[model samples]
Target: MLTGKKTIVFGERDEISATATSACLKAAGAEVVYENTACFV
Candidate 1:
């Protein structure tokens, strides 16, 4: 489990999955910097 750690999640295509992961990380005491949903062509 992550505790007092910083993280950034990029290019998460699924909204539910992204939100869930962010929530889990925060609950585990992680500082989520950013969550991006955009993709490059």
Candidate 2:
């Protein structure tokens, strides 16, 4: 179980996975710090 820690989620243009990851992490009681999106050409 996540008690005390930090979590970060990077979308990287993947909205589906990124949102899921963020939710999961939040549910686990993690302090999400940063999120960034990167577009690749």
* TM-scores for every candidate against the unseen true structure: 0.63, 0.55
Tens-place lDDT digits, model 1, residues 9-39: 6554543455667888999999888876653
Could you tell me the TM-score of candidate 2?
0.55
**How many clashing pairs per prediction, in order?**
0, 0
TM-score of 1: 0.63
lDDT of each residue in 1-41, candidate 2, tens digit only: 66567876787564445666777888888877876566564
Model 1 regions more than 4 Å off? 14-16, 38-41
Total clashing pairs in model 1: 0
